[model samples]
Target: MKLTIERAALLKSLAHVQSVVERRTTIPILSNVKLEGRSGRLSLNATDMDLDIAETVPADISQPGATTAPAHTFYDIVRKLPEGSQVEIEFKPDDGQMTLRSGRSKFSLSCLPVEDFPVLSGGEFPFSFTLTSSELKALIDRTRFAISTEETRYYLNGIYLHAATGSDGAMLRAVATDGHRLARAEVTMPEGASGMPGIIIPRKTVAEVRKLIDETDGEITVSLSETKLKFAFADAELTSKLIDGTFPDYERVIPTDNDKVLDVDCKSFAQAVDRVSAISTEKSRAIKLSIERGTATLSASSPESGSAVEEIEATYDSTPLEIGFNSRYLLDILSQVEGETARFAMADAASPTVVREVADSSAIYVLMPMRV
Candidate 1:
């Protein structure tokens, strides 16, 4: 490919595309990013055989051609160039080298045949809809922390994205769980989104897609089929394979009969959990919450480390309750709550507890207790 592109634009597109390329891939072509210059534009593509990203940037194309070059190396060359410098890239078909020239600097990189690059096909999508960037980003940020990392139960590995009927109306819901805790968040369903099939978006794909979703307020077109999903925004598109497993019935895990209520400031609760966990054992990392009357005390004890205790005022009217939880999991769910008060409905010391914001009803979280 022969093209002259602005350095800043090329670097921005490379930042999004090169991350999909593994640093030490076994396949030679997989380590390289394919570049195509055609019709006054340049296209960059990279894939890891599972998730693929393709980004296009405006360019001045002198000749139309295609080739593959080392993804990170090419990115570094373009990144180190001075600000506002224009980059000139040409593929020498005779010797199979890609030449890059900027200012007085000149470098030639070995290239592979572009035909060897893998393309992840997003088969036909029966359901398609549009959502604002902020809407999609909020869904990912609120629920992504609870995605399971265990390899055995692959069903809980990613977010369960589907449509649900909420108290407000039809909603788009995202749920994630790892046996210890679960998070469920919903937003108003955009137009024509009720027919989208529920799918387990793999953890990696969710992460990569989040990087592509910026902080803008523009609309993004989403298309999904049985086996694949695609996110299209701006001049970039991401296509990924869905996890091939059935998500467990998450509704069964959410507690509905809990009556004991504890209301506390969300920031203070998280801070207390962080403080007491300092003395917790590395293996268990458990912190116990002892609630009585109107006060709650968070305490942790370990054989090697000393004990830590922090008390916070809470509104609890039921009998004295003591529950244990992993400090990290407690903070993870609490951080998602933006309101002033975090309401917890606890059935007992052994059962799972339901947490939600006192003012917001769109998001609910369930946390399982640990043995003190």
Candidate 2:
């Protein structure tokens, strides 16, 4: 394949596609990106068996052909090339080596047969819908942090997305939990999403799609089946296989009838927890919250590191309550609140605490209390 493309455009597409290629792979072609040049455009594809990313960019085609080259190496070479320089890529059919020429620099890299690269079959999609870029970003950013890293409970490793009925009727919800904490976020459901199956999108795919959505304001076309999910946005597309397992019933864990309500500034509360937790033990990053009539005091003590105490003004009419929570969990939930104030609803020190953005109750977070 021979093509001339601008460095900036080439690098942008390369950056997206190459990130899907694994740094180490048992299969030779899996570590390389398939480059296809035909007509007036160049397509780059890379996959790690479970997930695949394909990107197409306009180019001046001199010879129509295709080949597979080392993903990271080719990306690095083009990234380090002089800015704004036109890149000429030529593949010698006889020797199977791809030559890259940009200004004064030239390099010959080994290539693999394009036929060896794996392409995920666009399986039969039973359901499809479109979502705004910003909405998808909000769902991922709010819940991804709660996905479990534990390999044993593989089902909890990705955000659980499906259709649900809320106070506003049917809505698209994304829920994630790691046993200790849970995040549930949703947006107005599109017409066709009512019968969509609940799918657990792997953590890696969520992160990749997040990056793609942030780069553009275009709508994302999502297609899903029983086993796989696909996201198409702008010039790029990502397809990933769903985790084959049943997600736990998350609703049962969310505490209801929590009578105590504490409203405090989200930023100040997070900072206070962070400051107090500094002296907490490494094993248990616990910060105790003692709430009374109109104030909340945060304290942390370690056998070896002494103790810390900080108070933040709050509005609480319920009886005094003392609860301990992991500092990291508190910070994670606080970061998701868009409003200046956070509302914490608690039943007792032993029960899970419900957290919501003071200005919006549509999104809720649940945190399990810990022993101080």
Candidate 3:
């Protein structure tokens, strides 16, 4: 394969595909990226057996052929080249080496047979839909922080994507939880997305797709089946294997009868929690919230570091209540609130507390109280 591509264009495509290659792999071919230069374009493909990314870019092709080469080394060579340089790539089958030339610098990367690379074929994605970049970003950002990192509950290690009918109309929802906290976000259900199977997209795949969304403002095409999911955005395509376990019924945990409401300025509440938590122990990270009719106080105490307390104005008319919550968890949920005020609905200090932005009903957060 012989092709000439701009250093900027080649580096951008390489950055996307090379991240899928593992730093250490037992199989030799898994360490290399499959490169195909044909039809005035160069296609770069890389996979770690479970997830795969393929990207294509315009290139000046002198010879049409395909080969495999080290993904990281090839990317590094092009990245260090001079700006605005034209990179010429050539592969000779007899020598089993791929050569890169730019300016006065030259690099030779060892090549492997293209046939040895594994292809993650997404067979027949019957359920397909499109989502704007902004919509997709909101869904991922609101829920991904609550995704479980525990290995035993493999099903909870990803976001649950499914279609549901609310009081307003049909909606597409993304829910994630780690037993201590839960986050749910939804958008207007797109046409052709009804009756789609509920799928648990792994954490790594969610992160990769989110990164791609930042590069374009155009609509993203999503295709999925029972076992696989594919995201096509910009000039790149990503395919990943879905988790093969059942997610728990999250509705059972969300409380609907919490009538006591407390509304506080998000910025002030978050700042107070951060200051008080400084005195709390590292392991517990616990902070106490004391809410009255029109005032709320946040306090934290540690045996070694003493105690701290701060009062913030709030709007609450219910019976006075005191609750203990993990300071870190509280701050994480607060960051998701886009509005100026955060509303918390609580039944008691022992029950789960529901939180949401005052102006946005599209997202909800639930936090479990802890002993102070």
Q: Evaluate all candidate structures by whole-model CA lDDT and list the values in order.
A: 0.92, 0.94, 0.94
Q: In model 3, which regions exceed 4 Å deviation?
A: none
Q: Which lDDT tens digits does candidate 1 get at residues 48-140?
A: 988899999999999999999999999999989999999999997889999999999999999998888887954698888998888898889
Q: By lDDT, is 1 or 3 better?
A: 3
Residues 21-49, candidate 2: write the lDDT tens digits: 89988899998999999989999999999
**Clash pairs (backbone) in predicted model 1:** none
After superposition, the stretches of candidate 1 with alpha carbons farther than 4 Å from their true spots are none
Model 1 worst lDDT run, 10 consecutive residues? 209-218
Candidate 1 similarity to native, TM-score: 0.97
Give the local distance difference test score of model 2: 0.94
Model 3 scores what on Cα lDDT? 0.94
Per-residue lDDT of model 3, residues 183-234, tens digit only: 9999999887899999999999998888888898999998999999999987
Clashes of 3: 0
